[model samples]
Target chain A: MSDWAQLKQALISGDGEELCRRVRQTLDQGVSAKDILNQALIPAMDVVGERMENEDMFIPEVLMAAKAMSAAVEILKPLLAADDLSAAGKVVIGTVKGDLHDIGKNLVAMMMESAGFEVKDLGVDVAPETFVAAARDNGAQLVCLSALLTTTMPMMKETVAALESSGLRDKVKVMVGGAPVTRAFAASINADGYAPDAGSAAKLAKSLVQ
Target chain B: MKSKGRRGGIYRPLTQDQVETIHDAALTILERVGFTYESGLDDLLEMLEGSGARVDREKARIAFPRSLVEAQTAKAPNRVILYGRSEDSHLDLQDDLVHLGTGGAAIKIVDPENGTARPSTLKDVYDLARLVDKLDNIHFYLRPCIPTDIPEAAYDVNVFYACFKGTRKHVMAGVNNEKSFHDVLELAALLADGMDALKARPFFSIITSFAISPLKFCTQSTRIMREANRHGIPVALSCAPMAGSTSPITMAGTLAQIHAEQLAGITVCQLTQPGAPVLYGGIPGMANLKTMGYLGGAVECGMMNAAIHQMAAHVGVPNYNSAGLSDAKIPDAQAGWEKALTIVLAAMGGSNYVHHAAGMLESMLAVAYEQFVIDDEIIGMSCKVLEGIPVDADRLALEVIESVGPGGNFMTSPHTMAHLHDEYFEGNGITDRKSRPKWEKDGAADAWARARRLVERLLSGEETPYISESLDRQIRERFEILL
Candidate 1:
């Protein structure tokens, strides 16, 4: 099989070592890093995202694809510039303060990664300023905030306000979600959009940036 | 020892020793903790006191002697015939019958046309009942939503009117007050022809939550229970004690308190009207510690509900419990899994009346029309498990297998055609079984969307209100019917 087809096969089957080895082999055989990324890796993730939307791919399989994709990207990160890597946009995601729930946020981050977005995941119990700082520092175009508790929901508003005060609010569109978070609550907090679950969160993030 | 449809010994949660221990603990709690009451039972307390219960009139606590508790419990029939409007639809709440149905008075629905959450109106109640009417797996119809547009004084009658117009299946709902309760009875009497006719085949039952958590009885609920008994009606004393908040934290402790509350309800129900039907209503579930809110998706809640059914079987009374609910806001994967786990546990454990078995979402705060149709299919599949593997001569099909040996196909064989329908539950209805291409061509609808399509198709068809036009007119004229 051709090198491109072999790389696609390895990525689709979620073979991280094979994907990385194939990336190295393709580069050694005189393929450019940008060609390997755009021709093979990016299109593979687009298919995975479509399958997920079709309900043929599940969360575990999507996470596995994300891991394999990340493994392949680690090999190419040194060779390619930041602008040539991902066309799925850049996103900053974090769970709000006083909420120790990480599973929902982690799922969303992984899904966004597999859907071809560059993500900066500030882990659980994140401060308001941390989100603003990371979005500004990373030049992120999308910010996704999550809170699993009703008490921590107010902290979402504070995070959005921190973005506004730090002068990055208008630069990046904000999305809020969690178990207790509603579209009305997102609107009350002046968020750009709200999603009920992780898959929808990824789709909403894509739409916001687009 | 196994009853007709209840598959036991495999799914038993409480062993005999554990059941006896819980039983003894419940009787002890009944005699010691008793029940605290506020008002409206001033006279019944006196009467029960005269009849051997130790009643403290001032502080209002009624303790039952073990002998009286046992005797009053014995007066309750092991089985009661709860009739639907048509005689063919009657339910024998006997020996762990495992009837699955809808429950909860949720005040909202996901408006079918737009898929947005909104307060449930009278039209939702009527349409849901019509859907439940055609669903074969849903055995009975309980009031699933509260009509937010109706006034409180006329709530009970109007809701029951909508339910009565929706299906001929046995309908159950809680009344607002004593006056509304009597008015509901009057409407039933009109439909059934007379008071005597209504009593002869009482098409509906009453659910009076007489027992409050932590061993107390609400006086209004107690009065309604008494009135139901006076008219010889079946009543369920729903006592939901959220564990870690209302009852003990341990599952065993929660079971003991809930069973004690059930016995207290039976003691009152039977003492007032001996031989009246009373269900062992034990809705014991746990509260999420992180939020201090009740979680219907808790696995412990399912385990406790399954265990309570065993306890009710030991006490020789029909059981009532809640299952098939989700804490998720929408009809998504979380809702599907939560409903799947709880419904299987409770149904297999032989809960006689598993209410809230359909359409409940967002921790029992809302119901969706699509969810009702979707849950109907879920329940259809769950009830399929109750039909244990038949392993006699014909089911083994040794002869057919030998004839269709080695490379021979059985799809065209006589044996395959003989028992296929009986052995298999033909699957469809919002639970997809189509090919990927077909499903995509059919609008790529999720379960929620498929269910919405089903709701639209079902609601658009002919109306099948079972009530007669004259009686319907009389009910509307005599009372303030909102629909």
Candidate 2:
């Protein structure tokens, strides 16, 4: 098989080391960085995501494939142009203030990154100002807020207000999620979208940006 | 509600010969493979050693001989009555009598007010019990959620107190430790007027998950089981082994392994106190191979749980099995279908003491209040199915049918009026049966929305405690009552 096929196989199988090695091998075989990425890594993750949606693949496997995809992209970063790196648009994400839950937030971030968005994850207990500033600095088109506690759900509304006051609300879409946040709550907070889980979060983020 | 402890066993998934084969295989497993105990349970090991079991002290393994297993199994009472607070609510488990209720130690609940998943608190425990008390179709109240708001030391007493405060149904829960177990017994004694009175009725029972899967015993839960047995409290030996991860991959193999585990627990319980009231608790489910998560809503899980009822019957013990689980995040169509299929199968297969029959979602990780209301309707229908058509001379309505023969209407017949409430199963109004115009005029609410409204209506006007004020105050003085 071709070198790109080998790289795709390794990435889908979650063999990160073999994936990176095959990336180098494909580069040595006179392949352009853009061709290797668009032809192999991106398509491999698309398959992984589809498999996940179809229940053929699960969260751990999808995360492993996402990790491998990032590692392969890292090797091709220097060779590719700046705009080509984030072809799917940039995003700012965080777990809102007073909420120390980041496992769900991290999963959504990884899924979004694998979906080709450049995600700047502002970890747990992030203030609304931090979210606004990160969105502005990253020139992001989307911001995803997560809160796992009922008490901290107000921070999601605060983050939305901060984005509106910062004059970035019209420029970017605000999506809220976590265990306690609902679609009606998202609408009540005047956010753009809400997704129940990580897989749907990535899909919703893509649609919101579009 | 109309038919409590209805005779089921109409839908047998396994043949008599197949059940005997599984039983024989389980006996062989106990005789050869045996079980390993944790290091600190040497006293339990010594007890087993004295009861004609070969003990490998070096490996902490106690292998039961076939004769010892048979003798111990025979010592357990076949018909165990889990007494409710009132005589009317007692659950009689014998001869394929089925009782379905709630069970889980879920950490999260879909908040009833806002429809968001949140950490389940002590109030949720009490509130859910109140719901169970009002819903006639849900027969008993197993402690559904853990009180995440309390300290670990206060968990057992507070949870039991919250359950007792909310409902008069037979309450069952797992204790945190031996001290808490004793504390709860004292608290029950206080409520029942005396220790002898409490022991005589046993308004509460203990669920001891003594056996780990694949022939291993959990140390703390085993100690709790021994104490419960000695105290003459009914205990369920809960052994949940996932098909692929914990036990064998095939259904029969999983059943064999779980059966062996149950036999081991029964042997220990009978050895501790002869003729102890024990349940053959077998919660066997297949693993989601991709994620290795417990697949609680799988139809195969329903099949295995149904088959476990037959296995328990073969061993002459009332079983504590599971059904009515849904993996759906909300009370949607997926949740409805998954829960209905499994619950009906278990009920038809005659699973006594069926828990997780209501208020569970996301494979027992979380529960939705609306789901409980919805599942009550489903379980009522299952019990109706279990009641099965009673065809006799007068019930066949031969003369009445001949009188109303070809072109007559029996809508206003005396026979119709006499059998109206008894014959047909009128659901608890959660299900909609209206024209499009009528449904639209009523806001076109789905099952979830309707169930939500029902839940709101039930919990809104309730502040009555099940226990008396004097007893509550006395118990409060004696223990740290968080509720």
Each candidate's interface RMSD: 12.0, 2.7
At residue B56, candidate 1 shows an lDDT of 82
* Candidate 2 local lDDT, residue B51: 79
* Per-candidate DockQ vs. reference: 0.02, 0.25
Local distance difference test, per candidate?
0.84, 0.89
| Candidate 1: clashing pairs of residues | none
Model 1: residues with Cα > 4 Å off, grouped in runs: A1-210, B1-10
Task: List runs of model 2 lying over 4 Å from the truth.
Answer: A1-55, A58-210
Model 1, span B385-475: residue lDDT tens: 7877889888899998899998989999988899877787654467788899999999998988888888888888899858878787888
Query: Local error of candidate 1 at B158, Å?
Result: 0.5
iRMS, model 2 (angstroms): 2.7
Q: Residue B217 in candidate 1 has what lDDT?
A: 86
